[model samples]
Target: MRTRAKICGITRIEDIHSAVNAGADAIGFVFFPPSPRSVTQEQAKELIQHVPAYVQTVGLFVNASLDEIEQILKQAPVDILQFHGDESPEQCQQISSQVGRRWYKAIQVKPELDVINTIKSYQNVGASAVLLDTWHPELKGGTGHSFDWSKFPKLDIPLILAGGLKPDNIEDAIKTTNAYAVDVSGGVESAKGIKDQQLIEQFMQGVQRGSAK
Candidate 1:
């Protein structure tokens, strides 16, 4: 199957068009306020307008309450919800069901952790997919740090390789992990929350080359 690409942390309408025009299957919007890439419900509503049909819109939340998510959905109803915080499998399922949307759970990959079991726990609970990302003590994601690709194992569900992915290394990442998809934010951006069109194109090109192998 072809590897899918999701361009995340989108802040501007131009970025949305850039990502879509560059063949991104999905566009992400951050709902968490602490991150510089975060966008308000209003901003997401306007930005999502530029996204054409068949290109998914994803909302990233960091331990947001049900009320908060519901309220945000009122204005900007994203196609998928990505839980990027310390949420349990039960919570992820609960919130996903309540919100009436499929969800992807982000796993912070570290050397000491039991990668297979952890991924299985979320998979058993019905996550649409598992996104493997670099682990950090304080930060949730967008760390721009990569974990050991050799640590990856064959899985039953679709795995989305994230963290530290850029035009330079994306091909190797895909070949090594054989990930069903890839998620990128800062890697394709000229600055925080601002995506570079040229970089986006390069990243997509890398994806195509990787998938071909």
Candidate 2:
């Protein structure tokens, strides 16, 4: 199967068009207030409206309350919810089920954690998939750093590789992790929250080449 590409941290309509035209499988919008890429519910609604069918729109949240999420969903219709915080599996399930949307839990890859077990724990709680991102002391994600790819473990659930993936390294990342999909944010950006069309296209091409092998 082809490794899917998700061009995340989209803050512009042109970037959405570029990602779609470049064959991105998913587009992500941040709802975390602290993120530079974060968009208001109204903004996300406007942006999501432009997304064509079959191209999934994902909402990224970090430690947001259920009420906050519910309110956002009422305005912006996202196909998937991504939790990138210290939320428990139960919390993820509660929020996802309450909204009736499939969700993915992002696990910050750290040296001490048993990554496989962590994924399984979230899977048991009804997470549709698990996203692995490089861990940062002061950040949840979008740190633009890579973890030790060799440390990846085999998983039954869908695995999404994120963090520090660029055009030049995406092929290697896919090959190393055998991830079901790849999520990129800062890697495709001209600046924080600004996606570059050329970089997005190059990253997708790299995913194609890597998955083909």
Candidate 3:
């Protein structure tokens, strides 16, 4: 089976075009205020215009209230919601139901975490998928460090392996986990919020090679 890829933290029209041209399945926009890659509703509304059909546009949120999310959705046409905060299963379902959009929950992987149960908790809770990211004390995600892949668990639902993925090791990551998809932001970036076209091309090539094997 071929693995899917999502190019995240898009901030420009050229980057969106580049990601779509490079065959990314999804493009992410950060809505959290604290993130360096965060975009306002106006910016997201404009940027989303460049995203063509079949290529999903994901909105990344961190502990945002229902009203805040609703306010953002009122202007930005996001296809999916990604919760990258300490939101519980109930809270996730509540927000998704209110917004009428499928959602994904990001689990920060740590050695002490019960990987399986934590993933299973989201089952029947309105999460379409689960994204596993490396844990960091200060940051929610987009940390350029990788976690212990050996701790990864197989799941019935889609598992998106993110964190520290780049051209150099993406093939190995795919070969190892056989994850449903991979989410990348900094891996193919020239700097935060800016994507490098050449790196995006290389990352896609790596994904193809890895899936073939």
Candidate 4:
């Protein structure tokens, strides 16, 4: 099967167009205020307006309240919700059910946690997929750091690999983990919150090459 790609942390209209043109299956908009790539509801609404129907739009949140999420969704046309914080399975289910959207939970891969069990836990709680990201105590994600790909466990649910993936290493990541899809932010950026069009294209090419192998 062809490996899918999600180009995340979109902050501008140009970047959105670039990602779409580069064949991104999904585009993510950060709603967490602490993230440098985060956008306002109005900003996300405007950016999402330019996105076509086929490309999925994801909203990234960090332990946001239902009210906050609802308020944002009221304006922005987000297709999926990605929880990237310390939300419990029940909390995730509650929010997703209330919003009536499929959701993904980001699992920060740490040596102490049983990765397989964590994935199963999220799946049991109704997560559509589990996004694997590098662990950092201070930063939830977008750390530009990579975890040990060798440690990934076999999973029934789709694995969306994230953290430190660039055009150079995306092929290696896919081949190693056999991930269903890949999510990239800092990897395709000229700077934090600034995406490079060429990098986006190269990343997609890498995904194609990796899937082919």
Candidate 5:
């Protein structure tokens, strides 16, 4: 019931302030060029300059090369990295070791997904936590498609629920998934990449209201 929240796909400076003001524990910037919310490393760095301490700056990526990841580390001071691609355990471990810190990996869960198997698949990958995100099958996250909540049984690892989570459904998603955290991207946006402050607040409130139960 007690779960943290992360709002991803931040493209504008005002949205960053809005998320922090709304009490989001973390804010994610999309580094994947294909995503509408994508930002350049320089832009990401500038956006993070005024981000207060205690609020994590998470960088989300697809299948990026290690060199590219290194470039990001050199350019931006991110607290966390979120790998949303088909990266192997060895690769994830390598990236964490390279960065001198642990990071999160997203597991694409299809309909009728089994939580146990999904957790095991990533446990050996040295992921700090496993995120249950919708798999578009053709795309890597940011699709706005969600998996069935009934599909997730019980999970043991630190779980962050994602995909199609918005003000209308976030509360129900958290209550049903029993996740340790909830991640929202396209859900609270006015468009593909633009974030709406009112929606962000309402979504966060919905999650809080649901957890109170």
Candidate 6:
């Protein structure tokens, strides 16, 4: 199967268009208020309106409460909900079912953690898929730091490779890990929350070329 591309941290309508034109299968909207990429519900609603029906719209949250998740769901109709925080499988499933959307769990891989058990934890939580991200003390994703691909363990669920992916290294990432899809945020931006079209295209090109190999 062809690799899927998700151009995350989209905050503008034009950027959404660029991602779609570049063949991105999904677009991410940040609901967390702490990060620079965080966008308000009103802004996301307006931006989401311009997106086509086929492309998925993902909402990123960092340990968000059920109330907050419900609020966003009411304000905007997100196609998928990405729990990017340290949420338990129960929490992930609860909010996902409450909102009635597909939930993908994010695993913060540390040095000593057992990779297989990590996958099992999310699976037990009822996540449809998992995103492998670099764990850091100060950051809540979009950190642009990559983990060791050799550290990746085998799994059957859909894997989305995140953290520090760029046009230059994306091909190798896919070839080595054979991830079903890739998620990127700061890798394609000149500044926080702002997308660079050329970089976006280059990233997509790299994904296509990598999958072909």
Report every candidate's CA lDDT. 0.94, 0.94, 0.93, 0.94, 0.84, 0.89
- TM per candidate comes to 0.98, 0.99, 0.98, 0.98, 0.94, 0.97
Once fitted onto the true fold, the runs of candidate 2 whose alpha carbons sit more than 4 angstroms away are none
16-73 per-residue lDDT for model 2 (tens digits): 9999999999999999989999999999999998899999999999999999999999
Q: Write the per-residue lDDT of candidate 6 for residues 1-213, one digit (tens) a residue.
A: 789989999998889999999999999999988989999999999999989989999999999998998888788888999999889888888888887899898887788878788788878778888999998887878878999988776788888889999989999999988998999989999899999999999999999988995
Residue-level lDDT tens digits of model 1 in 1-213? 779999999999999999999999999999999999999999999998999999999999999999999999999999999999989999999998998999989999976989889888999988999999999998999999899998877889999999999999999999998999999999998999999999999999999999995
Query: What's the CA error at residue 164 for candidate 2, in Å?
Result: 0.6
Q: Choose 4 or 6, whichever is better by TM-score.
A: 4
For candidate 4, lDDT tens digit of each residue in 114-135?
8888888889989999999999
* Model 2 residue-pair collision total: 0
lDDT of 5 by residue, 1-213 (tens): 468999998888899888999989998989999877899999998899868999988988787878899888898868888988878767877887887767888988865666577577667777778888887868888778788887755656788888888899988887887788999988889998789999999998987976876
Pairs of residues at least 3 apart in sequence or in different chains that clash in candidate 2: none
The per-prediction tally of clashing pairs is: 0, 0, 0, 0, 0, 0
Model 4: how far residue 173 lies from native, Å:
0.6
Q: Return the clash pairs for model 1, or none.
A: none
- For candidate 1, give the lDDT of residue 72: 98
After superposing all C-alphas onto the true structure, candidate 5 shows an RMSD in angstroms of 1.6
| TM-score computed on alpha carbons, candidate 3 | 0.98
lDDT for residue 137 in candidate 4, whole number 0-100:
86
